[model samples]
Target: MNLTSSIRSAFTPQGALRASINLGNPILACRDADGAARGVSVDLATRFAALLGVELELVVVDAAGKSVDVVVSEQADIGFFAIDPLRGEHIAFTAAYVLIEGCYLVRDDSSLRANEEVDAAAHRVVVGKGSAYDLYLTRTLQQARIVRSPTSPTVVDTFIEQGADVAAGVRQQLEADAHRIGGLRLLGERFMVIGQAMGTPKSRGEDAAAFLAQFIEEMKASGFVDEALARHGIEGASVAPAA
Candidate 1:
């Protein structure tokens, strides 16, 4: 479907599509060895801009919460985010384009052997402030004490420094940390699977959101998203199903 002029204006009042790229979610967006923003989310946003026939201006932020704030405040026209009810209040989300596993990482010798064993009164879980995992765990974890790290990438370091029992974050991030540092192991089962999607501020209106949603569905149906993931060498992330 062609993008209506009005919908296009709503999405990009500044003539360029300002896309918020969250650097915190490595599987979605991250800096390369050369310090360039390169990841599945960046590639997807570039494709969306091309489809709109507009220039793509990436607004890079280090955390998911900041990414949402930029879009909601109209500092950016759109952003990539993990779908969560808390974020839904401020932004209109497309059907998820990727599914990222969320799991706990603990020291190799820790007694927690499975995902189900994470929530206990004695366990202290460290999560990035305002992250998808933090929001989900806050609402669901009844027994464990949750601590906030400064950012998602710092969760593992924070866990080790604070002596927290578990570090909760994107599984890919934890896996990389496990390989880089010694004595870290992820639980065999995933506690949550974050649905990553493109979003615009709710102020952008339903028609604009709907237009973007259709674009996302088309990309998924045509395997654009899957191809982008492979091209970026993203692993442990799968293309989300059609809406």
Candidate 2:
């Protein structure tokens, strides 16, 4: 069957992406003031569904914790999240689409620099609880005392407001942070490069993995991904076929 047909038969009358997935999301999917799912996640999910000629059923998580319980519990077929190898053991990822660096976020008046110096015991670092950065900090910076916030915005805000020595998130997010939280500056070069990929249920079956891989490849070849990021004012981004 064609891709369209695959989508049609992929679920029952409920139109699930997979058998166990129950659609919902606060940011990605939501019952608007009138109860409707909307946001950047919605747009991406919609586009992917249209690309495959399928109906998208969103699955909402607590928007806290791992924030991917929908996919992890087999309640959803895929999820969009930052790519990390630590997560790779549990889930399959699409190709590296967007690049993010875990950088230090500090107050403009602060004497610290982003990624300028090694993390030491005296420097307190704040990151979202259960975030990829949290895992990185726990594993890499054994000496630094790590503090956890419940969300990305909170960490950025707290860091700017003098809640911690630094905060961590993508550079693109930092651009937004400068406007929303003020008095904050992104510090240092990237600590590590993280890619934005789709989370598919991990499996020995290459079908899902292969689809994600090809989706990323075609997006790069067509320039659609680049155009999308550029339109959003995100710069210095590129996509090239693997050598």
Candidate 3:
């Protein structure tokens, strides 16, 4: 894939490729011991910048909504996010490069043993504010109430603090929280499969969008995504099928 000047200019209007990285989702991006950003999404951002022959400037944020805002407002040239229809209005997303399970966590003593039992009048589901699960549940769960934490990493803590009936988020995050907090267990099944993908502002144009889409496909087919996940020690999420 040759980089056209137009595409390069579209992605580097600020003279460098600024990528918005959301630290909310541990499976995609996170801070290392030195507080530097390092994860699967960071690897892809670096590779994409190298391909464009530009410097990489990371616009690191702590929440998914903030990452989306950065890209949609063109403050960053690109971002990593879960594929969702509401976000699509302002952004053009590539086909997903990873598939993550969205699961529910509840106190072990609770009677909610199945995913189907969650959407009842008496249950209160807590999720990360503006996360993929938040958007999905807001649209789908009619009977249960939804509570939001400030960020994905805080979902479980907020759930416990608020005494919410359930906490919803990435399976890995929920599992880790369950282990760390104790007395919590995940439902037997996942509520959703989140498709994680790269996106750019729609103002970047169709050519830029197409180039990014092709780049993601190449990354997946070439096993770059898989290797990055393993390098980051990311588990529970699988590489998305080629689009």
Candidate 4:
């Protein structure tokens, strides 16, 4: 895609493409041994900056909500996030480049054997504050009470600490936590499928949004996203279909 002046200005008014990198989602991004951001999202942001012919300034944060805030407040040129209607009000999202499953976890002794058993008045569910699953469950789970953890990576810890009945988050994350912490098991089925996408502030205008959407489609078609996932050793997530 040609980097038109208007698209350039929309994406980099500050003379650099400030990409918000959320380390909270391990599948998308994480801190390396040296604490530098690295993962599929970081790779995508780097390539997008190269496409725009601008310097890339990563505005790294520890949580998904902070990433969304940086983009919606125009502090960053673009960010990666799960597609949600609430977030869409302030940010114009591109078509999803990856799809991830949202699953629930419980102590091994817990009676909740299936995903359908999670919603009950007696159940207190723990979730990453302002995460995709949090937003999703808040609207869908009619009876269960939600307890918010500081971030997605902390969901399992928070769940155990608070003695909550259920923990919710990305499947890969929950699985790793279950293996690390032990004595925890995931429900038989996923509760939701999160569509992870790139987004810019809505005020950036349609041209910028259109360009991002096109960029995602091209990346998916060219196998950039799939390659990034494989390069990062990401599991349990798939490249989204062309939009």
Off by over 4 Å in 3: none
lDDT of 2 by residue, 1-243 (tens): 134354344321345553111122112233457655544344556666676666777665433344566566666777766666677777787777656566677778777764645477778888877666777778888677888777655677666556677777656556677778677777767787656566676742456566666766666676776666555444544443441
Q: How many residue pairs clash (N, CA or C atoms closer than 3 angstroms) in each of the candidate models, in the order given?
A: 0, 13, 0, 0
- TM-score for candidate 1: 0.97
TM-score of each: 0.97, 0.76, 0.99, 0.99
Candidate 3: tens digits of C-alpha lDDT, residues 1-243 = 868999999999999999999999999999999999999999999999999999999999988988999999899999999999999999999999999999999999999899999999999999999999999999999999999999999999999999999999999999999999999999999889999999999999999999999999999999999999999999888999999
Model 2 scores a C-alpha lDDT of 0.60
Q: Alpha-carbon error at 48 in model 2, in Å?
A: 2.8
Runs with alpha carbons beyond 4 Å of true place in candidate 4: none
Highest lDDT: give the candidate number: 3
Residue 4 displacement (Å), model 1: 1.7
Which residue pairs in candidate 4 have backbone atoms (N, alpha carbon, C) closer than 3 angstroms, thus clashing? Answer: none
Q: Name the 10 consecutive residues with the lowest summed lDDT in model 2.
A: 19-28
Query: What is the lDDT for 119 in model 1?
Result: 86
Model 1 lDDT at residue 120: 96
* Residue-pair clash count for candidate 3: 0
